[model samples]
Target: MTVPLVFAAVFMWAMWDPTETLEDLPVALVNNDIAAGTGADRLAAGDEVAQTLLDSGALKFDAVDSDTAKAGLAAGDYYFVVSIPSNFSTTLSGIGGKTTAPALISITYNDNNTLLASSIGDSVMTAIRAEVVKGTAGSSVKTVVAGLDELSSGIREAATGSGQLHDGTSELSAGASELAKGLQNELVPGTAEAADGGRQLADGTGQLASGLTDLRAGTDELGAGATELADGIESIVGGVDAKGIAAQLAALKRALPNDPSLRGVVDELTGVVDGLAQLSSGSREIANQLTDPNADYRSGVNELVAGSIELNDGANELSTGLGQLNTGAQEAATGAAQLADGANQLDAGAGELSAGLSDGARQAPELGDDVAQQSLADLLATPVDTKASNVAAAQFNGPGAAPLLLILLTALVPLIVFMCCKPLRASASQPRRMSLRTWLRRVAFVGGVSLLASAACTAIVWVALSPSPDPAELGKTLLMVAAATLMHTAVIAVMFAIGGYVVGAVTALAGIMLQMFTFGGVWMIETVPGLLKWLNPIMPMTYVREGFISSFNGSPGFWSALVIVVGIGVVATGVHLLLVRERAPHDEPLAAGSQPA
Candidate 1:
């Protein structure tokens, strides 16, 4: 009773709340990292990481130099040593720069102290890595998000500018189109008409020049005719004198004064002479006026001929100028037509440009405020958030190890009981019929005692370690213990019955070792050696441990494990029965009252 209880107590005490010892577990921390960046941007990544680990309270960390840390780890003063190299800060700081390799946090551990220490160190390093990655990645993401925000703003501004440009281009296209229409529909035809008019005017001017030349020649002839007429009149006036004619008329009248008829003749002749004198005076005045150098008629005819000649020369020049102008106008009209075509193309191109710019402006994105941007950055930085549901998590190492210890204790009970109690008591006086009955009775007695011992060990473990709180789970655990105890008891009994004391003891011890090794109490079955893994399926204690753990955790698999355990127990019991029956027939008659060996 004391032996099994003592074993349980020792195992529970050793394994109880192992993590609690981490608070005092000494580890070395060495920071050889230099600061990165300049002035205000300088960052001491090593110091920061050290501080984080120190604050985490995960383990007892002793800040030490490199040599000291190494010596301490070798001498078993420290379980593990975490060292930050000089490039840690520089490498981490240069994340987006040329640095492609990851910043390393070196972990050195000494398994001489405890192999578990190395595992613990690995776990700690993993946590440190995660924290460092989170900080660095979050910062990088924030910067990227901020840049994205700026890019968004720039895009929005560009969109606005594009919209304005589109509006301006739209107006320009419309104006260009109107200019092209005016040039094509109005200016071109007008220029052509002007060219036609110029041609017509040239022809008219040429005709006018010819007419003016003819008029000038006629004027010159008129001037010469006027002069000749004036000269002829003057000569006639010089030939006849008016005064002489008047005197002759008077003398003729005096001679004819003697008779009345003669006097009538004299009066008529005097009138005639008076008329002749008046005619002669008028002719003389006309000749004088025509022959005068300063006369208005002669000067006017000369001036008119000179003006007509000048006019003729001007008309010829005008005709030549009109012909040149007509040619120029024709060229201008052709240029205008080409310009109109170019303007029309320009209008169409500008319209398309405007439409394209407008579409681009409409398609541009808009980003919100700083707060929203930051939230998005954080989300992108750490996209996944994990949640764990620990269904039947153990709070401490003691409770977690309770099932293994309990199963071990239960298995040991049969070994302890069978060590003192004999499985078979045969004698020559004992009849063959009593052999089966006697074996049954001994099995029942041993099994009952083993069950009691298993329950007592379980109670001791529960009271000492506080393995579980649920009454139902505890009851199931007890049931698993009872089943395991019965199975072990049957196995030990059969071994003793078939092989006797020495063989039974050796077989029971070996079976216990095999079961314990393969049951995954110390290590997981998958992690065990090949032989152990193969034996794990057949080991009754493996199911016992499984059932115990299942029941303790209030999970499934208890019933299946219980069934397998009971079946193994039944098989062992049947084998024991068969051995007992076979031996019953072979038993020689021992002297009456003599005990069986």
Candidate 2:
């Protein structure tokens, strides 16, 4: 009984409160860090760290002179001395290195004084270092987040620009597409047709050219003939004058009338002479028409030659224009193809950029939420920040006391009952224990008594600590305490039934030790060693501790805890009744005896 009480007291004293040891621990802090640069680039990391530590209230930090801190460590007056180097802010802020060098921190410890205390001091320094890094990173994250915000703004602007570009390109593509279609369907074909017509015209002009050359040769022949006719007519006219022609005709007529036979001959001769004169006059008129200078065959031939030359020139120009048109048509088709392809590529690129920007806009709200409280420079410099939050917080100084007390009561209650109570017997005279039913009834009575005691303790802790202000949470606390107590009574009573009083007391001590290692009442179960974590699910106190935290914090997991605690009691009772082999022989009375090792 005394042993169980002592064990409970020691366990409670060691881990009843959270963070108290860390808060009260004496440590010396010295800040010698200073900014190396001027303006906004300047930063004092040591002073910032000191301010954060003070704000968080995570440590019992003392600002002391460097020499005094060093003396204190040597004299065992302080756990350790923490001195911030002169280059602390300069190195961390990278004002000197421009991000080429990493920040460095130095801690001095007197391990000879107390190794555990020194280790703890080192841990505290590590935590301070972490806090400093967090603050610095938050500043940097604020800068980066701001830059991201600006980038997002820029992307949105770019998206707007891209949309306008898309519209312009779409119209361009449409025009290019139509141009390509026209080249393929109309202009190129029409140009080919015009080229064909030009070829036909060229051929016709060549034939006309040949015809003109023939006509020119023919005109030369006609001129030569006309000149010969004119010369012949002139010669004939010169020989036959009008007066001589008339006298000749008269003589012929006079001769014809004189001679009868001669008359016939004379008449024929006159007719012949008259015919010759008429032919000569006609020849002169023909010569005059052919040789006239103002409007004659020669001038007409010259005009014809000029017209043929003009026609030939015009045919050549048409052929040349058609050739250029054909070439231009092909070039236009090629250009349209290139334009369409370029427009398509531009449209695709713009669309992708726009889509990516839209997605980034969609995600901006979440990112903005993360860096809402930070600044632009900090976000840019340090883009990531790490933080921690507890879902089920103790929130009070003595919230852990309930779980710690519950664990104690679980062991100590049974120890006290067994030490104080009398054993069940069939009768006073016989002094032998009754059947297993008698044992169970006595265990039930002890459980009832333990429940009342546990409830009372729970109420006391609730009123004093007010771990949870809610009425529902207080009710849950009472439930957990009662369940834990009943289970403790069942398990310890079962141990006594199976192995007597010593085993019961030893079982209680063992249970407390298991609870100490496996229970998450003080340190989180996740932070414990692997083996202890492995045993965490198996320990009944694990559930009780979890239940207490949940109840106080208004979280879940109470039902699960209640189920496990009740199951433990039921199983323990069953094991006690069925599995225990008492030391007494068969058909003999049950009596107290030592358990097997």
Candidate 3:
């Protein structure tokens, strides 16, 4: 009884509430991360994470340098070491920059120290990663919110500017329309009238040139006539001898009579001769003035004729240019009309653009308030929070494992009993055969003692561990233990009866190991090897362990597993009765009451 209890005590004590002792497990935390950004944007992610782990009390985390952490982990002073690199914060802060890389948190574990230590480190790292992600995401979102606020402001200003632009464009379009209309209606028609006037002026200038040419010819004839008349008069004056004739008239007047009337008639004849001389002199002066190169009349007439000819040529050129100008004006009128239409279209487009900008400004989100923006950022960063619940939660590891230990201890009782004792008390040399009823009674007595011993071992472990406080669960577990004890006892009895004590002991120990391996004790059934898996369903320990576990967990498999365990015990006992038969009369020893060689 003490032997089974001693083994159970050692196993239970080792596995009892392992998680509760996690704080005693030494783990090194090495923080090498440099702060990222400056001033308001500064973040010390490694320090923050290290502090959180320390404060959480999840594991005993010792803050140490990298060398210390490594030495401690190697020397088994620490179960695991968590190291945050120098670029941790910097890499996290680079999320929105031109280049980005994942922030690495390294965890090193020594499986030699403890196999489960690595799994614990993995869990701790996962939690730390989540926290880092939340913090970094929140910061990134805040930056995005700030940018959006600035964007909204810029859009509002643009909307106002666009509105002003629309107004300006409206005035510009109106002015352009007026200019186009003036060009088309007033300027174009006025240019055409001016061209017509230019053509008429050219015709008038041509006429004036022709008239001047005729006047020039007439002036030439007049100059020639004047010269001829002057020459004839000068000759007449020379030939007539006007002065001598005047003297002769005066003499004749004196010879005729000294009377006043005779003298007056001679004087009148003299006056006529003198007047003819004066006319010849005036004609010579007029001819000289008309024909002289230095005279104004001849020069003026020549200049006038040359000027008219040049004027007429200029007028002809002006008329041709005016005709071209008129054609150009007509084209300009059509172009101006098109320009006015284009300006109107431009104004319409500007109005639409202004309205679009205004609508955009109105629709833009208002993220200006810092308080509201931060709150929004935080909400967006961590959208979902998880709350976990376990329906069949175990308080400690000891209570959940008590059933497996009880089953193991109970199985040990029958093996130890059968190792020293025989299955049947009758001697092999006996000639008379023992009745089945007597044989069963002898076996029942031994089985009863083994069952009592098994019950005591199981009860001791159950009470010490207090696997379940409920009387119903304890009762069910004890019933399964009784069935397991009987099954092991029958099975081991058959082996010892057939193969003697040494073989029976070896086979019993081997069966125990095999049962443990296949019955979800050392490893789960699914993970066990294929040969073991095939033997798992038939193993008596399988139902016994399952029944005990089901009873503790308050589940449905207890009754079914209990029935199976009882059935296997019945079969093993039947096989033991059939296989280990009493020796026959001839098969007995040669001498009665003597042992067989």
Residue lDDT tens for model 1, 173-278: 5666676566656766666676566656656655665575576466556556655665565566557665676577668767665788877876787676666655
Q: Please write out the lDDT profile of model 2 over residues 1-597, one tens digit for every residue.
A: 665676666455444333454665566777787766778866766787667766666666788988877766554456556666777666665421133334554566533233244344555666665666564545445555556666667767777777787778778778888888889789988999999899889878877877887886776676567667767866776686655756776776675557777776656666666766766776655544445434466566566777777887799799889989988998998888888888888877777777776665554433345434343344334422222221112335334344465556666766676656643212223333336655555567777766766666656655765443332377786777777777767677666655455755666666767667566554434334555668778887777765665565455567887888889978876665554323322233334551111
lDDT of 2 at 538: 85
| Shift of residue 475 alpha carbon in model 3, Å | 54
Clashes of each: 1, 17, 0
Weakest 10 consecutive residues, lDDT, candidate 2?
384-393
Question: After aligning candidate 2 to the native by TM-score, how far in Å is the CA of 309 from where it should be?
Answer: 4.2
Weakest lDDT window of 10 consecutive positions for candidate 3: 385-394
Best of the candidates, TM-score: 2
**What lDDT is obtained when candidate 1 is compared to the true structure?**
0.64
Ranking by lDDT: 3, 1, 2
User: Which one wins on lDDT?
Assistant: 3
lDDT-superior candidate, 1 or 3: 3
